[model samples]
Target: MTKKTQTPAVQKGNTDPNTLQLHKDPAQTDAAQIAAMALGSVAANAMTARSFAKGTFGTLDVTECVMTLKQRVDTTHGGDLKHAETTLTAQAATLDAIFNEMARRAALNMGEYLDATERYMRLALKAQGQCRATLETLAAIKNPPIVFARQANIAHGPQQINNEAISGTTTTRARKTRTRQNELLEEPQHGSTQLDDRTTPASARGHTAVEAVEPIHRTTKRRRESSGGA
Candidate 1:
């Protein structure tokens, strides 16, 4: 019986619950989480402000016009409204300042979060790529016992054992040579050359026109009057 080399999951060490290994790099992830949480806190505070948590005045209640025609009357709704309006206006300005501050803080926190997120995203992507490369290498060498031992002792240092990349320069050169040979030996076969119908052309133009047709099938459930059952 042939033994299976290594399962992809096993090779990648995906048994761990954490998508990323926390022990490998905890500080960075923690910093990223903190930034994200700070942004959330700022947003929550902004929401509370909108919910009138501090009772910021939305509108000032002003009387349209309650004019008294009585001469020497001790009552005055006009004065009361004027006083209320003046007080509310100043309060509204103060509320505006508070709202603006909340918005500023929220924006500032969000900016930090965005910056942190961008940084971590880049890091995560790089790590993910590295993990993928490692898994691929692991998978490629799982069957090869010699390579398995070589990869087992893999470590970062000045003496990095790299596989020399054989570039496609030779392949390109061969292709160019083949192209030149084809040019020298071959003639334009499509323009002037004629091909028999039975012998299909080496370079034939494909038919593009689609034949239009009327619908041929019809569905019927009724019996004809002349052919009706007696």
Candidate 2:
């Protein structure tokens, strides 16, 4: 029998969960957790919006309007929500940097801290502005006036009018072509010099005589060819 090798046991460390570790700060950790939670919530909401767009919510009550708005958001501002989420995540990393710097120094300069905080705050405000813009766009999508304006623009555009005219002309030409083809198919094919009632002999039943005759010009040409051959 072959001898089996035993795996080494993992070592455990005596570290305090609540206390800040070397090169790590508890404040930044807390900030990171908060940011993660916030981002998770936003992601969850976006998923819910997507479900609403799919008509998961029954077509009853005020949910129908909500569903419509959700669909419009998905169509028009698809990237907005993701961009906002990304901005928040980046800001969270910035927060971690800020807090790490604070942890490194025994005493931080108030002026510098204030400046960094202000800059971060501006970024946060910009993210908030983006969120607000997305909401405003959703509102516009839901607005009847805006919807009607879009419809009217589509209906009365010069290109649309030209397309309609071209379609009509094409349809008319197709119909005329079909009618001509049908007439050609229905008409009898016969040589020229059709026999008239006076020239044709009457039938035994006293019916007006109708006979297929070779064209006079063709008969004459055939006779000339035969004479030349002879």
Candidate 3:
């Protein structure tokens, strides 16, 4: 058994092109190889760097999903990608310092970008609301009567639900009950007289002195009537 191995084209010393059936114009091998390399490179880098940049511009895609090196344009003469990349790499020290500081503070690579974007959005919304409120207030101040939009009476819970009418009725009934109870406790006084028994005797108080003297005249009249009848 023999070990198999790959062999290069006709050796440099071999000289029989027709008899050995070796290839003519040996430069074809080099040209074919160069062509294969060129086509492979082109196929590898079909998406230009500019296209990748546009795809990723202002978008918050994850780091793992970012553009790849092969996505950059393939060229013997370096283009904008070379310059832009060189410039960016030149400042990589500063970027690395920023990244280190952020990491020390426990920041994720994509989290910083996303956090800044979200913060900006929130601030923008807050500023918009403030501007709107300011405009409304200024408009109100300019008018003579200064009519302002009424704020909605947002009831937080059951505190104000049917509370006003019910509370008023309960209060009124309580007051009326208190008034009736007070009137019952407060009685009116009738007319009153003041008297003293200081001058009256204990025994003769039953008959007055004028009533005792009235019997004398009645007895004389009765005696004259009896004589006339005899």
Candidate 4:
């Protein structure tokens, strides 16, 4: 006869039960987090691609799906600019056709002198304007306008100096040291000085100097006397 072994059992309300410990690897934990993030990103992109493909192509055809994705990629890569050029060109041609048809109907209606003749002429003019606008838009797209930016300084303090070349030369310009107050107070080297001094006579300041003039009649009488005596 064999006897069975009996195991001990703990009470239901026991606070100290059993516990197991495990060590974690830092490198493995980091790698696992990175993998999870990558998968989540892939799932998000798949959802986006599916939505775009469904909306654009209506059916998930492989060619159309790829084309739709390619369009998005092209837009990101600035391919829309080239697309715009061709689209505008086509629009301009369409507008020209519309203008011609409208003008022909207007001419025929004018000869008939019908009640809608004025309306036809009006529509023709409108189409002509629209065609002109389309052509102008195409021209603008082909040749963009050049923008000129100039820096200007406005203040009451000392004059501002610019380091940039005025025309195209790299030569530095002479500093401007003269102002309105300086001109009025300082004596000039070339022209007449505005300020009068005791050392320099007013006549020495050139034709611009201020001085009293003799009376015209007295000078004429003196000239006559000198002529008579001669």
State the RMSD for candidate 2: 24.2
My TM-score estimates for the predictions, one after another, are: 0.17, 0.18, 0.17, 0.39
Best by TM-score: 4
Q: Score residue 80 of candidate 2 by CA lDDT.
A: 45
Better of 1 and 4 by TM-score: 4
Report the C-alpha lDDT of model 3 over 198-228, residue by residue, as the tens digit: 6442332343555555555544444444545
Residue 15 alpha-carbon offset, candidate 2, angstroms: 43
Cα lDDT tens digits, model 1, 1-230, are 99989757644444432122222356568777656634654333433444452366552111101111121122233333443344445555554555455445445556567765555455545544554555454444444444322222335775655343554787799999988876654556443243335755565565669566788898886876785668
lDDT of each: 0.47, 0.51, 0.46, 0.60
Distance (Å) between predicted and true CA of 81, model 2?
16
The global Cα lDDT (0 to 1) of model 3 is 0.46
Residue pairs in collision within model 2 = none
Off by over 4 Å in 2: 1-112, 146-230
lDDT of 4 by residue, 110-187 (tens): 767776677777777787787788778878878889876666665678877554424454332222334545666656
lDDT, residue 110, model 4? 79
